[model samples]
Every structure is written in C-alpha cells, then in structure tokens.
Target chain A: MAKREYSYYPGCSSQKGASSSNMMKSVATMCEELDVQLNEIPDWNCCSASIGYGSGGELPRLVMSARNIALSEEHNPDQDIVATCAACWLSTREAAERFEDDENMFKEANEALAEAGMKLTNKTPIRHMAEVLIEDIGYEEIGKGVKKPLEGVKIAGYVGCQTNRPFGIDGESYENPMYLDGLVDALGGDSIPTYEKKVQCCGGALAFSEPEKSQEMIKGIIEAAYDNDADMIATPCPLCQANVEIYQDQINAKYGTKFDMPVVYYSQLISVAYGRNANDAALNGQIIKARKLEEIAAK
Target chain B: MSTNTAMVEKYRNNFLKEVEANVEEGEWVKMCMQCGVCAGSCPLGNAWEHPPQEIFMMIRAGKREDVLTSDSMWMCTSCYNCIVRCPRELPITHIMHGLAHYAKRLGIQPKGNPTQWFSEVFWNNMMKKGRVNELKLGLSMYFKDGFVSGIKESLKNAKLGMNMQKTKRMAPMEFFGGHGVKNPGDLQKIIKKAQELEAARIEEHGK
Candidate 1:
C-alpha cells in the first residue's frame, strides 16, 4: 500500500502535558500502523478555538486560522490540512468556507495576511483526523491492521458536538452518527447500535466556565452509556474524551451514583487493537482506566 | 454618547435591527419562527434565563438592555446543538457568541461572567506566543479569584495534576516557556491589523 501523507494540525490541547496530549500520542501510533504519515504544519498558530470567539471576535478569529492555513499552504502545498482537534478543524474549515462564500472577507483576510508577509489562497482542504481515517482509509483496510480484535468489549460510540453537527462525517445522521460505532465494529468490538446519546454535547469549553451546568450535561452522557450496559465509551473529539472521563468522580459525588465508566479515544482503541501496548495506546493517561483495553493490550 | 445608547438611538428602538446591523450572524435572528426548538435543544436550556428562542423574541420586542446585559449568551458552550436542531437553520452558536461579543463591545455584558473572563484570558495567553501555554492557562484559571483560592483549587486538583505528570501527559517545563510560533511578532502584527480592519468595517456598517 502507498503511504498517505497530509499536513497535521495538533491543536493546543494535544500539546505535550496538555489536556489531551495522550490523544496525540495514541493517534501518532495508530497512524503509523495504518500507513498514514502526518507532517506537522510548521510554526502553526492557534485556530482560535470555539471559546475564543468572544475575545478573538470575527475577523481576528478568521485571520488567526488564515495564518495557519497560509503557513500550511506555503510549507505543505496541495496537501489537505488535517486537524486532530475538532475545534481546530471546525474553526479553520469555517474560515475557509466563509472566505469562499464571501469575497470581501477573503480580500480583507488576505490583507491581514499580507501584514505578516503571507496570503491565503484558501486552496487546501481542512479535515478532521476521523474523516481521514474513515474516508481516506476504509474500514476494511483499518480492520486488516488490527492484530488483536476486541471481541467482547461493548463500546458506546460517543460522537460529541463539533464533529457531528453543522459538518459531520459524510452520510451520517446528525441525530445519530454511526461512524464511531462503525469503527468499533471494524475493530471487532460490539458497538451498541442504539446508543441514544451518541450525538449529545459534552459541554465543550464551558466545562471550565460553567462546571455545574456542564457537569449536568455530562451526567446525562455517562448515564446513557451505563444504561446501555457498555463496558466503555469511545469518542472522536479530545474535549469529549477529557470532559466525559475527567468529571466522572465529581458527577458521581454530585449525583450520588456510581459512575466509573472509562472513556477512551477512538485512536487509543485502534492503537490497542493494532497490538500496541498500553504506553503506545496512551492508556495510562486516562483518568478512569480502560482496564479491559489494558488487559487486551497486555495480551 | 455611549456606544450602547448611541446604538439604541441609531436603531430608533428596533433592537433586532441593531443586532442585525452589528452582531455576527445576527441577521439570522429575525428568521426564527419561534418554534422553540433552539430553547428545547440547548444542553443548558433550563439554566438559561432566556433561552435562544426567548432571546430572539426579546430582541424583536426591543428589550435592549435586558438582552445585552443579560448573562444568557455567556452560558453558551458552542456545542452547535441548537444550530443543528434549529428549523430555521440559524447559526445559533455563532449568534450566541456574537451577542456576547456585541454586549461586551457595547460595555454592557454582565459583570464577572466566568466564560467571558476565560475567553479573554485564553486569547491573551495565545496571543503572547501564538500558541496557548496550557500550564499557564490552567494556573491562571485556578488563581483567577485570588492567591488563597488558587492554592485551594490547586490542592483540589493535585491528584489530577499528578496523574497527568505520571502519565507523561503534562510538562512542568511549559510554565517557564512552552512551544511557540517562530515569529510571534509577525502573528501579533497580523492580529493588530485584522482588529483595525474589523473596527473600520463595523464603523462602516453602523452608518
């Protein structure tokens, strides 16, 4: 098989020791096995995440992403720009889409870009890492690389907000995206097909600002997972994985329920199923350990 | 004249028209059929004093101060739930943020809104080096109230912090100076120019 290479944008949360650093690690390992080469966009800036809209405002937010795309276009021209972070993908793609639809904004964005000796031609495609995995590399190809099939593990595929609504994986319903479940099944795990809260919001950046309200929303997500009798939850977005997994203890305390559900990234699960150890799968970083996946990795 | 009052005078009591003229994606606010799907679809709908639908109605009703000064828009998580679920296909998430931004621009946003506060902090931190220093961002959040409460917040999350370090998920080195763009000065210049351009555009739109 020919190697596939794309410019990679690892958002702030995935930086070392950051909130979702483990995701970066596991995704790197998974991509290696899948023969996808990710070339990091050199000296990239923030995409001015969803939380940034209030302070960053409209044009500044667009310009911030425009700079990164400008850099990517100059450095890795013609290659599609892929972001592992849902926010990065959404923000950058939104900028490009807006620029395409609005000519004046494009001209102004380019004017700003010229301040830094750059210009946004806006030619490259901005995509999420999941889109690359599902579309670029088919499930059959992904399944072929799984050395240790997760036979008995039942996964509630959580397709949290950004990656689902507005712009989701192609052909998947907004009410219930099945790509996560499809990936799980491909890896030989039993995906709960009727997981109703699959497209629920995990509170995103508000998890910090409004903890109680965010936790209330998160509580519903975890409760739905437990109700479906899933062993673990697998998700595509880093915020979803972090928000859902890190807050379980607090939720249990607040709600007076025993909620110890393990939330792992789809990449980590893929890495583990590809015969990588816990370290390779970045499983140790999980707040609530996926003991079942750990055991599988150990084997 | 204060921008808020000036805007009120300029619009001549039509708050919805003011929003349409100023806020990002605010034009879509008038398209809301009041189906209440946005209100029902919001994850924090119950917590919202005025859900998206009510907020739209308030704008149409010309409740200027109530709509701008209210904390409702700040409660948005930008989950895009309302956007996807809206029958009118309003970019509800952007509108929520736009309302918050517009309120802040007019100097009428609710005081001490945590989301607004953090957004500012995150933007400043990112602008410094063109990439967020996560460790510093975390510390800033923990210490936002004061040193004593910061210490308390640190201790409360000590276990989580230690777990992060043990798992090699966080780097203490990031506190001194983490990774950044090679030419942050260039990025800053671009941002400054962009801000100036946006201001000029808004001024033109106001007329």
Candidate 2:
C-alpha cells in the first residue's frame, strides 16, 4: 500500500501539554505503521486562539494562522495540513476561508506576512485529525490495527465548540456528527450520545476573564456527562482539556456530584484501546482520575 | 413627532456610540427590532434589571448612560447566546462586554454582587501567574463572595483534585508562584499592556 503522508501542525498547546503531546506522538507512531506519514510543520507559530482574537480583532489572529498555513502550503501544495488542536484547526480553517472570501483583507494580511517573509494562499485545506483518521483512512483499517479493544468501557465524546460549530464545512455537521463515534467504535468502545452542552464552550478564555460564570458553564457539561453515566470524556482541544480537567473538582463541589470522569485526548484513548501502554498514553492522574478506567479496562 | 423625537434624544449617551464604533463585523445594532429573542434566550435574563433586548433597545435609543449604568450590564453571562441567535446577528454579548469596560470607567458598580469580586480575583490570579490558579482563586472568591457552602463542598472534591495534581494532570498551586518572575516587574508590564490596549481602544472610539 502507498504511504499516506500529511503535513501536521501541532500548535502551541500540544507543544506544552502532556496528554496532547503524548497522544500526537502515539498517533504519529500509529500512522507510520498504517503507512501514513505525519510530517510536523517546521517553525509553526501560535494559532492566536480565542484570546488572541477576542483581545484584539480577527485580523491579527487570522494573519498569524494564515502565515502558518502559507508555510505549510509552500512545503506541500496538495496534502491537507492536519491540525491536532481544535482551536488551531478552527483558526486555520477560518483564515483559509477568509483569505479566499475577503480580497481586501487577504491582500492586507499577505502584505503584513511579506514583512515576516511569508505568503498567504487559500489552497491548503485544514483537516482536523479526527476527520483525517475517519474519512480518508477507513475505520476497518484502524480496527485491524487495534491490539486491544476498549470493550465495556463507555466514552463520552465531547467535540467542543470549534470543531463542529458554525457548520458549513464539507462532511462536518453540528447535528449528528459521527467522526468521533466512528473512531471510538473502531477502538472497541461504545460512544454515547452527548448532551446538548456537548458542543458548548469549555470556558476557555472565560476561565480567566470570568471565573464564576466559567465555573458554572464547566459544571454544566461535567454534570451532563456524569448524568449520562460516561466513564470517561475525550476531546480534541488541549485548552478544553486543561479547563475541563482543572476545574473538575470545583464542578464536583458546586454540584455535589462525585464525577471521577477522566478527560483524555481522543488520541490517547485510541492509543490505550490499541494496547499501547496506558501510562504511555498519559492516562494516569488525569484531572478526573482514571483509576476507575484502569479498573474497568482490567476487568 | 416633535415630542417623541425630543423624548428619544433626551436619553442619548456614549454607550451606544461606543458600541457602534467597537462593532467590527456582523449586523450592527440598527437591525434590532426589540424582538426579545436575546432576552428570552438569555440564561441570566431574569436576574438582570434589563434583559439583552432591553439593552439593545436602550443602546439604539442612544441611552448610553442608562445602558452603561444599568445593573443589567453586569448580569451578562457572556455565553454568546445572544450573539449566536440574534436575527440581526449583532454581537450583543460583546457589546455587553464593551459596556462593562465603559462602566468601570464611569465608576458604576456591577449590578450582581459577585461580578466585581470575581473579576478582581480572576485578574489578580492572571496578573500574578500569567494564568489562573483555580484553587487559589476559588478560595479567594469563596471568602470574598461569602460562598462558604461552595467552599465546604470544594473541600470534599479537594481530595480528587490532589490526586489529579499528583499525576500532573492538573497544575499545582505552586505553578502560580514562580511563573518565571523574580519580582513584580513582570506583573507591572502585563497591567501596563492592558492599560495601553484600553487606552488605544478609547482613542479609536473617541470615548
């Protein structure tokens, strides 16, 4: 079989965080075995997520993400730039859309990029890892690769707001999104239907800008997951993971619910189900401890 | 017509003007028909003196001070529900934020009791660590806001939190301490940058 190689952009969160970084490494290793090469983009910059755009305007953040996309395009003209971070994926996708739709903005942004020795073009498609894994690479292929199936372990897939919101992307929908569910099924687990708040914000910048309100919002999601009997929660965004995991205790306190639901990067869960080392997947000491997960997986 | 126009003109203020100037994209406020969809959809609307629709109406009528000083300005959850649902596509939530900033300048107190307290603790944590320490901030907020019940409940979850911390899944409280700063100088720079951004925005809007 021919190797499927993609230019990967790990973004800032993956570079600093443990679960995201570890999972990306595992995904890369898995991809290599599956004849898929994930080449990391060189000298990538920040995606300038919610904070960057919310503090300033979209132009600055868009241009920054555009510069990174432009770099990826220069390296590979045909293959999509696969982004692991949901925020990075959203920003890069929005930037590409804007570059193609808004001529004046594109021209000005490209001019700004020229000073930094970058060019902006609307050619390269931004694919979230979830999409690339499920859509381009078949689930049966992944099922064949799974050394250990996560049988009897129930996972609540939290898609986060950015990955599937504001709709209109090809093969992506706000309602009835199936990419994550398919991935979970391939790894030998049951993916439960998430609550209405599944697509809600993980209270990203709001965590700093408005703590109490953010806490309430985070509590709402965790409570919903607990109410649904999910053993663990998986998401693609590192900031979402950080916010949701860090605040799990506070949510438990506020709602008086004992939710020991471990928040893992979806890739990490995939790694675990594939019989990769659970610790290697960085599953222990998760914000919501996964001791229960370890126990369940053992049985 | 003359009487009604005069009455409308009497309520004019800078809050609406500032909102108009700060809105970068999407439908402007002129499209608001007072449908009350924003207010109705708001999770915190009942708690506010003026719901989101009322705020939009007040702003449209140029009642800037009324909108800015209204306790409802602080009641916004910033959920972006109004922004997401507005038929006019007005950035209603963001306008509320801009009004909050303006309200601070006007020396108006936030309507809800917890708004100022939460804001201070949150920003202080951010200024000190360049990130939020949820435990420290939560405790500070518990005392400052008198949410003792919340704190007592938090203690039970503290055991779970500690376990997470041990695994390094959660950030340690000490992470907020070092933050790569030897002195308060770094903190000062962050505050200065914020002040500069606010000043630049004010200048652009002539507020």
Candidate 3:
C-alpha cells in the first residue's frame, strides 16, 4: 500500500501561538509513527474566521480561504487539506463547501485565486486534524501507541464552537457532539461530562472587539471546569487556547478564586501521556499554571 | 379583570428592544419566555443589577437605554448559560454582546473595573499589529490594568513561559506575522463591513 499522507495547513493560530505550534509538532511526531505524512502547504493565507466574516462579509473571507485551498490543490490532487486551527478549519471547510455549492461564487473565488497564481476546483476536503485523528485514524489505533496513559486526572474537553457548530457533520448535532470525549476516554483519561458552554465560542477575535466581555466568557468556561471538578481543560483550537490561557489569570483575579488548572491542547496531553518529554510535548506554557502533570511525569 | 401576559411579556422590551435591531440571531429573541432559568443558571447573575432574565424583559419593553447604560451589561460573562437553558433559546448572550459594543461606541464606560484595562490594551495591541502578540499583550494588559502587584508573582513563573517560547513548546509569535490587512484599501474593505452593520443597527433603532 502507498504511504498515506495529507497536506497540512497550520493556519495563523498554530503559526503564532506557541502552545498550538507545539501541539502540531507533537502531532507530527505521532503522525510519523502512524505512517501519516503531513505536507505543509506553502504560501497559505489567513482563514478569516468569525473576525473576517464579521468585518468583511462572506465573499472576501471566502476568497481568502479559497486561495489557501487552491494552494493545497496545486500540491495534491483529491487529498484532504488538514488544519490544526479551528478558525482555519471552519473557514476553509465553509469556503470549500461554498465553492462546490455555488457556481457563480465559485467562479468569482477562482478568479481571485488567479491573482495569487492559484485556482480552486473543489477537489479536496478541508479537515481539522482532530477530525483526521478521531474519524480517520480511530481512537483504538491511537490508544495502541500509548506507552503512558493519562490516569487519575480529570479532564474537561472543550471542542469550541467552530468544530461542532454550523452543523458540519451529517447526522451529528454540533451541540451534543462526543468526538473529543471519545478520544480522551480512549487515552485512559477521565473525560469530565460537561453541558452547553463546552462548545461555546471562546471569544476568539472578540478579545479585540470586546475584551472584558471576552474575559467574562473565558471566566465562565473556567468556572464551569472548576464546578465540574476538572483538573485541566483540553482543546483543539489555537484561538481557544490563546484566549482561555490568557484570560485564566484574569478570571482568577476577577473572582478571587484559585483556578490554577492547566489548559492544554488535546494532542499535547496525548503526547505527554505517551511518555514523550514534557518539553517535547510542549507542556511548559500552559495557561492554568499547574505543575502537577509535569511533576508526575518527572517522577 | 386580569389580562394574561407574563411579567416577562410585560417587561420584555427591557432587554429585547436594546437588541431588537442588532441581534444576529433575531429568531431567538422572539422565543424568550422570561422563565428566569437564564438568570438562575448565570454564574455571575448575583453581581448584576438586572440578571439575564430581567435584562431580557427590559429588552422586550424597548427600554434600550437602560440596558445599554446599566452596569448589568458589563457583568454578563457571555457564558451562554441563558442561551442554553432558555426554553426560548433567545440569543441572550448575543444581545448582551451587541449592547456592549453599542455602549462602547457611545462612550458608556464601566466604572472602577480592572477588566477595562484589558479592553484598552487588547485594542491598542490589535490596532498596532493588526493581531495579538501574547507576551507583550499580556504584560501590557497587566501593567495597564494596575495588576502590577500581580506582575512580580506572574514573573516568578516567567521562566516556564520563556522556556516554552524558546524551545517552541508554545506557538511562536511570528506565525501571525503582521499579515493583517495592511493595504489601506484592504483595511477599508474590512472596516466598511462593520460600518454597514453598525449603520443598519442604528437605522433600525431610529437613532
């Protein structure tokens, strides 16, 4: 059988956010072991997520995402474009869907791509790395590679709004999705049960548009995790990581509550549990400021 | 001769009207039943003068100014508790957000709150770089917000953050790369959309 590979688009968040980049690095290592190749698409641009749409309408946003997709198409025919950023996944997935669904819109988008020396044919699927792992690779296979399991720790899995919302998967309601929880459970960690806010927006760019309000949203998530008695929170989106991590301290200060739990990328947790070095797994910059995991791993 | 309309129905405009023209999910607003479930589940409802349920009532009563000017808007955490628990699924959170934006535009600042420092620093960072630089942004927020006392405490743990940044344990700042819409035209294109939305909102409210 030919070696399986997918073109990876790191998107803005992964490129800029250290935690997100580390998660991608760990994911790349795991992918290597799993016989999966991640080809980084060159010259890819922004996904223009909620911020873009809120600021620039759908067409400009679609054109921006389509340009990135076009770059992926030039490199690979009929291969899915895997993304690590939730905003990228949402934007690219929406753009790909729109390009395929609307002929006129597709022509306009392709025309814009031509300016960037690219073209979109709707030939590839835009996928979140989490989707590729959970849906394509399967948790059982991932579990098989685990040299160290994350035992005795309670984890609150935050999927964020983009991954599960706008009704992406067929027959799966975004609100009550269990894909991340399944992966966490497969890794032998306790996936704490959570309700509605688990999938709410982490106030991504709203950190710019409305900072205090955004912090409030972050505080709410932290509070929920605390209420659930979770030791940490895990997520797949870089924006969510950045927002939740940055606001956690503020949240703690605002309410005079001690929420010193770590917020990590799901892949980082997996990489750590697989006996990877804490440095290798990028556990150092976690927002919640907990050293328990590192202490345990050191032992 | 008691005519039947819920208190929420009578006071609906308290919150709803403030959001009447601005809500992205307007369908949710009409479905609110004033069940108080939203306020009841709200984590910070105790801090608000008008909890989520009352805010919604105020909105529905066309009492837009009260909701917009009230400190209650700032107290909302945007946690979506009201949105989730409301049988009506009224976009309570959305309304609150819209009101906040509106209030900001009108210069209705929150009093004696450290959270305001976050807003100032965040926008200043974004306005300059067109994207957030976490390390600088965080420090700016802390310093500007008068959290200088917390700075030394936070710095004690700075080694971890610095190490992560150095060893690539965390995402690097260069990835965002100031690639924001730099061209004047592109920036305008982005700004115009927001302007249109704001204009439409104001027109709807007869402002």
Candidate 4:
C-alpha cells in the first residue's frame, strides 16, 4: 500500500469556540491510528457552507470552494482532498459537480483563481473522511486496529442530510445510508439498527437563526436516538454532532422529555477504540459526558 | 383583449421568468409536479409557511407576492431531503436558497424572518475576515436585533460558551484574536475577482 495520504479540509467549524474542532481533533487522532497521513490543505478557505448558500449567490459560493480545490491541486495534485465536515464535503463536491455541469461557472471560478495565480480543472476528488474509512479502510481492518472494542456502548449512527443525497457515497441509498451502522458494528459496539432519523437534518446553522424550529428538528433526532435505546449518537458531520450534543438541555426543557444521549463524532469512538487517550480525541469538548466511554477507554 | 391583457399583467408571468433567471438551477422549478415529497421530507417542513411543493405551485400561479414573502425560502437548511425525493429530481434546496437571496436582493424578505438577519450577519462576518470568527459572528448576530437582544442572547448561551471555553476550544483571548485564517489578503483577492466576474456575467446577460 502506498501509505494513505490526504489533503485535509477541516472547514471553519474547526476553529476555536466552534463545536467542530473536537471533531477535527478526533479525526486527526483517528487518522494517525489508521496510518493515514493528513496533510492540511495550506490556506484552505471556507467551503462557504449553507450559510454561504443562504446569503450569497452561486458564483461567489462556487469560487469560495474552488479556491480550496485549486490550492489542493496546486500542492497535492495526486492526493484526494478529504473533508471531515459534511458541509465542506457537500459544498466542495457540489461546486466540483456544478463546474463540470456548467462551463460558464467553471470559467468564472477559474477567473477568481487566476487572481491568486492558480486554476483548477475541478478534477480534485473531494471526499469525506468517513468515505476514506469505509471504502479504503475496510471494516475488518478497522476491527483489527481496535484495542478496545467498546463492547457495551449502543450508538445510533446519525448520517445527517448533506452526506447522503444528490451526491452520497457511491451506490449508497439516499434515504438509508448504512455506512455508519456498519462502522459501529466494526467497532464492536451495539448499533441502533432501525434508527429512523438516521438521515434526518440537524437544522444546520438554523440552530442560530430559527432556534425554535431547529430545536424541533434536534428534538426529533435526539429523541429518536433515545427511543431506540442508544447510549449515544455518533455522526460524521460536526454540525450534527454539535447541534444534537449542545442543545439537549434546551430540547429537554422545550419538549418536556428527558434526553441525555451524548452526540459524538464517529472518529472519537474510533480513536478511543484504537487506544488513543481522551485528549487526543478531544473528548473534553463533548458537552454530554460519556461515562461509558470513559470507563471503557480507561480499561 | 384589453381585459385579458390586463389579467395577464396582474398575474405577471414575469414573476416566474424573474425567479428562473435569478436562481442557479431555477429553470428546473418548472418541472415540479406538486408531488409534495419535498414538503414531506423536509426536516423543518412544518415550519415552512408554504412548504417546497406549494412554493413551486405559487411560482407557477404567478403569486409573486406570496412566493417572495413566504418564510419557506428563509427556512431551508439546505438539507437536500426534498431534492433526493423529488419525483422529477428537482433541486428543491437550491431553488429555495435562490429565492432567499433573490428575496433579499429585491428588498422583499419577510419582516420577521430572523433567518434572513442571521444569515446576513454570518455572511458579512465571512466577507470581512475571509473566514468566520465564531465569537465575532455570534456577537454580530446576537446584537443584530439590538444591544439588549445581544446581551440576552449571550446570557442565554453563556453556559454553552462556558463549556466551550473550559474545553479550551475557545479562549478569552479569542475575543481579541486567534480565529481568522492566515493571509486574509489572498482570500479577499479571490473574493473580489469572483465578484467582478459575476458582475460581468450579469452585464452580459443584461439582467
């Protein structure tokens, strides 16, 4: 194997005070354990997440992602760009696809790149980290790498909206993405097999603007996890993890339900399983403390 | 002929024409068959004043006022649930977002749409620094309604803020700095170029 390497785009969410930095840290540890070299894409700008879509027009948003793609091609042309943030993955993939579909948009994006002395073919394969694990690091390899199996923890694999639609992992169903469940099983943990809200949207940044409505969506997702007997919820998207994890108390207060499921990045669980310490996986940032995780990892 | 022409003018087909031109994949909005799957699949579908399916209907009926004024455009989290489920493969998410930007540009956004305010605040933060400074963005958004609202919002989220701080993901010094990406000059240059290109395209299309 030509030692797996990737141009990582941690996205803006990975910055300080943001919930997704834990995810970024968790992914860094998981990558090390999996023998993956994550080379951060130098000067990678925002993927111009949905808020970008909501506020700006197509060309600006496309150019924002294009700059990152162009930078990746300039520096790491051979390696595919892997994004831990689902919105980043979706935004970059959508931009690449849009460029392919519209020559005019491509020309405009390139015009923006040219200002920075760069241009892109939109050829860089933008992939999610989860895709790297599921497709490249097979479940058996993942199982073999696990030092602690996380035997009793029951996780509801929440895929959220961006990863599995219009452009999901190759051949995965839009409505029901099974990659996360398989990942949980590989970790030797119990998965909520019939997790109904697996593909539900976590209201993304709406948790900022339309807090009530976003809370309703969050309520449904968390309640579903609890209803299915999940010890915690695991996800690939930082927005999903953050929204579900940080908002539980508010959701409980509003909905009159007692929900305490710890929402975590899948990488956190994998890192723990692979014998890394809590700090490496950035467990400190997790709002809902997972005593189960702490106990298991301590073993 | 006079009466019929007057009726056509009132229900301006130009409304649909304008949206189609403004939206990226707006032409596809014409393909919506009222399947209602979009409305059914949306996570915040209940919140939409007129859900995705009806927005399409409103577009066709030339109900320009209703379509632009609806909170549905502002409420789209871009979940893509509707796009994947649309029988015609309509990019419902994009259309909703397009309408939102269009609504803002036209100065017709619904009065009470906090989403509109928040997105603009978030967007402006990115535009200024070339990346989002979470604290700055939050401060801007909270203060957007006014100073009092800003304090209230901060107090409300104080616990969450404290938790983030304790984890060391965000530090007190971040209020002074430590959030933006390096080399903001380069980021701004790219943005300027993109805007110029976009402006030229609009001029070419004579829109």
Against the unseen true structure, what C-alpha lDDT does each candidate score? 0.89, 0.62, 0.62, 0.81
Give one digit per residue, the lDDT tens place, for model 2 in B22-103. Answer: 4343236667778888887665566678887777777777675576567675665444556657777776765665556555
Task: Indicate whether candidate 3 or candidate 4 has the larger TM-score.
Answer: 4
Poorly placed runs, candidate 1 (over 4 Å): none
> Which ranges in model 3 have alpha carbons more than 4 Å from their true place?
A1-3, A16-19, A168-172, A194-197, A289-292, B1-207
Candidate 1, A45-90: lDDT as tens digits:
9888888888878889899999989989999988999999889999
lDDT per residue (tens digit) for residues A175-240 in model 2: 546666777888888888654556666666556445666778777777777777877777776767
Ranked by DockQ from best down, the candidates are: 1, 4, 2, 3
Quote the chain B TM-score of every prediction. 0.95, 0.68, 0.65, 0.86
Model 4, position B187: C-alpha lDDT score: 75
* DockQ leader: 1
Query: Candidate 4 DockQ category?
Result: medium
Cα displacement (Å) at residue A27, model 1? 1.0
Worst 10 residues of 1 chain A by lDDT: A245-254
How well is each residue in B71-146 modelled by candidate 1, as lDDT tens digits? 9999888888898888778999999999998888877888798888899998999999999887788788889899
2 or 4: which has the higher lDDT? Answer: 4
State the interface C-alpha RMSD of candidate 4.
1.7
Instruction: Name the candidate that leads on TM-score.
Output: 1
For candidate 2 chain B, the 10 contiguous residues with the lowest summed lDDT are B178-187
lDDT of 4 by residue, B51-77 (tens): 987888888888887888788888888
